[model samples]
Target: MRRVSIFVLCTAFLALTLSTGCGGGGEEGPPDSGTPYVPPVPDAGPPDAGPKPDAGPLDLAPPVVLSHSPEANATGVPPESFIEVNFSEAMQTSRGTLQIIPGDGLPNNGLLVARPEYWDVTRRTVRFSFPLGLPLRAFLTVNLANFADVAGNVTQGFRTFAFTVSDGVAPSVSSTSPSEGASSVPLSTSEIVINFNQPMDTSVGTLVPGGGLSLGTPSWTGNQALRAPITSTLVNNGLYSVRLENFRNINVKAMDGAPYLGDGKLDFGTGPDTIAPTVREASPVEGATNQQYESTRFVVFTFSEPMDTNLGMAELVDGSTRTPLATSFSGDGFTVTCDAQFKLRPGATLRVELTGFKDRAGNALVTTPFLGSNGALDFTMAPDTVKPYVTQTNVPEGATDVYPVEVFSSAGNPGYRKVFTFRFSEPMDPSVTLVTLHDAQLPSSFRNLAGVWSPDRLTMTLTISPPSSGLPPIEADKLQYLELNRLKDATGNLLDTTIPPLGDGRLNFRTLLNQRELNHACEHAETQGPLLVTATSSVTAGTPRSDVLHGLYELTLPGSGNTFSGYTRAQLITNQTQPIFMNGAPELTVTDPASPQTGIGVTLLPVPPACPSITHEARFGTVASPLNLRFSHGQQRLRIVLEDTY
Candidate 1:
């Protein structure tokens, strides 16, 4: 058998070798003798193709903004400059929202209606154009959102920026002294003054003189005014002309870097000033009564012609004592104002005397004493004893149940009229009468109070407004007070607080309580009980029931009951077992079912009482007993007894 197998294997090996070596198509192969045979490995689908031909890296990052025109917070940008934005990558043009919002001062103060003009060839930049151009000197904001790349990645980074447009109005001259075609201008005028409509760049511009006129070095006072002094004496009855060349404002420039427009030539005729300056008007006219006596008081003298301010001397005289005044001249040299070095005595006749004064042409005054006959600039100072005081008020002292209709109300309400009117004994100085309104209950509570003086300056109408943030309002059910500090009259006399009624310059009044405020007070009286309740009777027929009920009573108002039930603390001492029911209206009423006499009938005068006198009545058998009720501390302490009729 072995021999036979060996022969068969030899024959198969030979056949496989011939077929595999000679390229014959045959599959005769076997392992040696007893070895195991294995099948050929399956194909791995074309050898993996070398990592699938490399598709490149993933695009997971967001797109970025590369740059923008009219850079962030850039000022003085041309109004017509196109706005452009460049992105780091090509972006989708139709996928974003662009808005241009004006910060201020434009017909369209809100969002500007504009659209992108076009995207560049690379699709990375976009430009926007406004047909009418942006408003001059306006602040604007450019906002962008949802700008995505072609790869579906939204843009990341700053999406909004602000810029300011340039001022476009050219500089021009508003006015000039010795105006165009002016005649009889003073030959002694020291300078040619030019006033610009706006501030100018003083570094540039020249004042060219003509008509035999020569100008000295020019000087500027606050860039808005230019002064060119005359170096040579001007000729009398001569014509003059001056041209302002290359003058421009600090912001005047065109987009092409061109200079802005400026004022043209100014021409005038000069005439000799032969007339002497004389006092034409005086602040305190001769024989004037009741002038201010304070040191800050000014005695002014207006001259008929411009004067040489440097050559002037004046004095204020009271009797034989004379004092020099600190004097200053008006800009045009047409008025001389004198300030007193010391406070003038009250109730004195004062006179202002000008000894030596000259006009611009060195002409002396015709008369030495310039104002009145013998220069009697005489005026009487107000007497210090004649002080201002509150004569009357629209709201009376200790007034109760007063409505704050005019004092405090919502806007547009007819009740929004003056709340208080204070009539003074004399005309008071409105500037120094610092009258303020405050809350009596809240010591630190002050209102936004304003006052309007009558035409005569004797009466003031007060209006109260809401206080600043975090402060309470002057609402209903409040005790308001008025305070006058540093209130003075025109003569600098202080307010007299020793007057009747408002003795301390203060007036207290109570506002009427609304339904909500009354309910709140009732709730507080209920929860925080033991309010003092004192009572007495006026019936003299039998045993006079004086102090009928005087004790701390626990109050209870159950479930919207406008009536209060009082439980006395000392029930045995009072010998009162039945509960006393008290009505909680403006006219309160008290009753007890167990009592034979009609229980105390309390009538609150003026509703919400502010130290108000109340009327009370009690009945026993056929006699009617009159009583008086008083509320001391709001509704905390109450008394019902016989005192005044009302």
Candidate 2:
């Protein structure tokens, strides 16, 4: 047919050029149809295989955080701490994650997850378990987020860290109040305390006032005690010392906060009273004469033992010029005064003298040529025509509650403010009675101030500030008549707006919330009998009414770290709000008992309004039972049925 189809296409193209071998020189291509053609090699299939292209997507890399363990800020650490971390590869233990964060004294807020107690088999370390042990002085932190890595790559961590724990136990001074070589210790021995051996850190522990001794405000009674007090200048029997100074800022740390490593000092003495404060009673009684010009004068001295209110004074001569006196002292430092600017000439004669005194043991009064005969006086005057009048007052005119205890026992409890005097019968004219003695209800720019007058000007006092810590059932409403009405009288007249108290002078009174809690339990009674205690519960029946609800009885003696000297019913009710009824033997005096009959009593009852009820009571006495009973915040639960002492 076309030559038999070209001989079957030339025998299938010569069987595809004899299985695809195109020769060059010995060419058989196309049957040499062209003599130089060589083309048949197409069977290279099976050797080319088929599966190999993904080495491209399996390599990741992000998992770091290869080490950890209480190593960050470290520090003592022993309340039972445990933290470990380590992870650079393994990890993916279900995605991992952890968090801790607490800073001071810790309470809760810590999270964790990595299961299997998070062991270390390529699960990449972990291990955190504080259960209930990490809190004494805490700091913590430790984060470690997300975590991954089984090629899921994550965790590239540093995570976060910090650590503290502390049990290295350091804070010392287990006891001391006047002990170490203690002698008579009384310049009125205010306080000393100290205790410690643990539980401190309310600010590091500081007492200071060293060698010559001074200290005044240093507080803290429970977490191991502290107290302080002293300062009214102390001295008296002299030879003091007092230190402590540890501070990381309050430093005295212990409960694990550590600190209080050095300075504790101590040493005491004072109780010889060497007798040197004369003037044991003065006030125009040393020479006596006519007296009475415009009255309102004052001189008072009475000091047989404690004085040195920075060396007192009081002058009014007529032949040596000297006038600088503004005194005030009587919280039992033994009276002093001077008052009444001294302006009386009438028949003329005057003398009065007295000078720079001293006592608290340093002794020294006869200053220059004055105090020689126990101090001078002389007097004479007597002309004044009579116009003043308001007689005595500190809170009387119809008294009701009353007990501002002279503004918190002379500078304590809200302390300082609460003045309120008013004597006047004459001596008027402190520029017109400090601008017309006021408090009419207050604000005429609020006047009413004219203290220090009685050396025979006939009296004229009038003060009036009050209110920082006294009126809560504590009293002071009726000042009823401390009035003055533009005052006058040094010889100018005026004052007597028709009497009834210079014209209305109202001073209504009303505070005695239990008479300053019975004068703070009769000034802290202590019939003597071993003493050392501790009690706490500031307000926990419902929580909230704190005019100082009494939570710490703390007297220190029942064993651990003793020492806790006088004054503490919260330093005698600070910023008080009444409600007191204390008792513990002569004001808690243990002197150094520590055992025997160890008793400490306290009672605060008067928080009745609606919030948390409140009515406290506490008694401690037990060297094997002198009668130990304890109760708190009223609900009425006194059983009483003992009988097991055989």
Candidate 3:
């Protein structure tokens, strides 16, 4: 160990001459030639922790320095470089006691802060690189007695590291935000925060885009500890550019392997640097239930652009007549009104055309005749269809009877049939029950609910037995008409539309002569086997009338999706009940306009009631002239009509 100490001292003496460069002299014999520093040995008297015994013999010595990176006078170190020293032996990792004081840049000037470039631990060397290699004279001074060795020994020394760049150059400057090849950017980037190598004079920045709408000059303001540039609001839905156009002329260039080492550096040399902001599709195509086609009072038009109202009435269309209804426009307006006489005939179609609406860019539309993909563009109005039907003529088509002597004819001859049926355009509620039987008035309590039939399936039968007692006390045997409004066809649409309605709502009859009532043997209801009876007299008024003298149930075929339009009066015949079902197929007939001579017969409606809505329809004519009654998707009901009445 003594021999190594001597060798170390010899090397230090030589280094002192190499850097100090002092000539042989008297008082300054040699650097580090002064009295050698020594540490005091521990006191042995009672081993007390009192003031370290006054000055025993100097026996303890501090560890000596071995080597350092950037050896003694290395040059061109980066700003982010570190300083490190190797002791004569292994030491502890104590960083707080170690530091490198930079020669340039103010304290905490966002530069030269903890610049630990990299550490070659295997070789015990630390280094930091500069933002850019700089060419300036910088110094690294280390304090004394900071770090200690495993032997509790520290270097009793203060050392300095200084270097100079031979050539006169500075650090390189680059901007990252307003990128070099960028064409469009934020025109109002208020903070132009630029990063520097060592330290920089950050009093240069500008903003404000103007003149031709390019980037404008930015106001340089060091706010919140930053070299910021101020500008106005950014362009809405468009793009603009920004640039470090001008600043105080401060120049800098990079040293080979270090940061630019110079002060007062700003926008040394630079000039200024535009993206188009696009349209996304419109909803509800042009001709949808749009403003023109929705029942005059229910149309609306919405667009993606600031609509121009000058184009006016050409925006929407009425599907039925293809006529133009004036359209009123508003930014947030969703509803509009139309003139009177707004109605669509049932079983009709319409077309909606649009070709003159303009966009915000004033570009006229490119598409026309836009139809609702859902097929709602075609709406039809129901036509007038209230015709009294000859539901059941008990007297057949022709018959007669004589009085007194010869007496009224037999049951068949006298045309004494007592059952009949009929239905109106719409249905009447049984709640408002009405009836007029024979020549007497009967109460509803004695009336039974009539059975209904499907328009799509026209034939039906009532499994009912009417009661019979005797003639009524009032009008006896007149047996004239049956009056009742308590009959409806599913939909609440009523059968009567007039204030007082039309005629007597009854069918006439005729009777034949030459027959007489047989006054044969007689038997009462009890004596007979549940008699489906024929009374000897008409219902007596003021008496307990058992049987319902009158009642009615109806069905129709002339609404939205039915099949009864375009047929001449002759081809239309209202029937008594639903037709027969053959192996599930219905046997039916209607006057098909396509073939008028003989009526058309079929098993199913040309169009069927598809679930909640009607798909197939009744055909009184060719396809174009068929009626369209339907079971609407939302309205869970079927409509009925007296087939030929429309």
Candidate 4:
């Protein structure tokens, strides 16, 4: 069995030697064409070293600041200079943090934070910039932290740098309540407010007022504003001045900070009015009697100066009752009118009391309640039962040669014909007061009259027009009469017709004659002598005598027949010069009788004589006399003397 095993091992060895080559160096030949050759693969040591995934290198170094402007511990740095920081290596640009804090060690103090504004293309350099400069004279600290590298390595701790900004400017005034050179400032300004451009040190500064101005202690607000109270009353229309001295900023420096050198003086002016107002005059004057108690009646007060209408109040007191009156001011503020809102008692004495009145310049009235006899405005109210009567009229009782139309184009009404105006003693009711015009040539039933009342209903203007039918136009050279019948006052009082002449509501007047007759009469009177005419009655005509009356003829008036107290004279001179007299008898002159002829009229020179003056002229017979001296129309030969008092 051993010999057979040896033979098997020799056979294996001989096969291996035939497949492997010997150690001798020799070139190999090509393999047989029947089989293909295969190449061997190289061995790798571990699975981890064969074709691993790509990942960046692990870095743990933090970023550092390379350089910074306004270096640490720097002084005298300009406030307008910008702060800059440069990083040493590339950083996580968005993750960096920087802080500039005030070095006062106070919490809640203002601070500045740095933000990166630029980065290089290589991502290795980062810079921070400040656009708006820093605060003046500020001690600031720059802190750097939270800066990370691209590999996620943050800064370990904070890096701090300290510096200071320089300042050479002084504080200045920004504004004032009443600016410099201001005018019309109120005299009641209680305080003055001052604003500064920078925070100030109020402990060391002083504010002084001049020009008779007084001020109290000043207080500071927010280190930039000061308020000073007024210590005394300011004068009206006065000038004042103020000044600031030794004013400095809160930031103290060596040898004391430089003081403000700008304009330190402030000037202003006050208002221009100060006089108090007083009552100058009043209507329905004090102690007045017969004052009508009607709606149109107003109690008016005139002031010495313009008043402040909004500030005053007035009231009307009647016996024990007090009532508020509606007050209104005139456009000029010089007159105040009071109207009663309630009905006033008849025959009662009333008083108007004023209070709290002031002028435009804030001056109170000199005398309260308008100082009077009893310290109030007093007037007696007229009884309502008093009858209304004619106070005056445009056409008197014996007015002659009066124009038919008083005003032709009145109030833009070209056709409005006003012949007569009748004024009443009190406001009358137009509904009850009736006016009629009666023509001597027209029938009694022919009524052709229209009337218009004044705004206060106290006067009536009569206009005459032809009737719509049957009546002819108003004829000239005829007698026209006006009758006011059934007249009543505003309070229903009947008219009092017991008075003389027009008091009975009757007025008689003669119209002018034709132009031809008037011309003929005027020619005849110019050639005729100054004839002697008789005076029969005060308001009537008398026949003429044959004797020529020349020179001055004096006539004494009786006391019981007239309101005159002196004698009157008639001067009938044709071509003589006037005679001047001194305190002699009142005289009437008749020299030129041809001109201004009305209905065959004779012109009387100085027609109305002056006695105790013209207001109290002597009458020939009665109160209503001497209206005109003329002759009857169409009767040139027959001369007559007519009344000539108006």
TM-score for each candidate, following the candidate numbering: 0.26, 0.27, 0.25, 0.29
Worst ten in a row by lDDT for model 3: 517-526
By summed lDDT, the worst window of 10 consecutive residues in model 1 runs over 569-578
lDDT (Cα, tens digit) per residue for candidate 3, span 1-646: 1112333445666668667755665575455777874533322334332224243443346656676655566555444344555555544444313334553453333133222334344323333343543324555554434544434455566544454332333333333344333344453444444443333234543433332233233333342122344344433234333333233222322222222212222211121211211112223333333223222433344443344466634323344245565566564322222222233222244433444565543555433233345322333334333332224332332222311011123432321223334433322333433444332233332334344343421222222222442321112223233444444333333434232232344322322221111110011101222212111111123112111111110122122452222111221123422221111111234433445445444335422111111223333332322312111122212222222111
- Between 2 and 4, whose lDDT is larger? 4
What residue pairs are clashing in model 1? 628-641
**Model 2 worst lDDT run, 10 consecutive residues:** 637-646
Cα lDDT of model 1 by residue, 152-236, tens digit: 6776643898898887666577677867668788766788888887667778888899888899999999988898888876756
Compare the candidates by TM-score and give the number of the best one: 4
Please give the TM-score that candidate 1 achieves against the real structure: 0.26
Count of clashing residue pairs in every prediction: 1, 68, 76, 9
Question: What is the clash count of model 3?
Answer: 76
lDDT of each: 0.60, 0.51, 0.33, 0.58
Residues 96-149 of candidate 4: C-alpha lDDT, one tens digit per residue: 655778634322233433334555665555554444556678888878777777
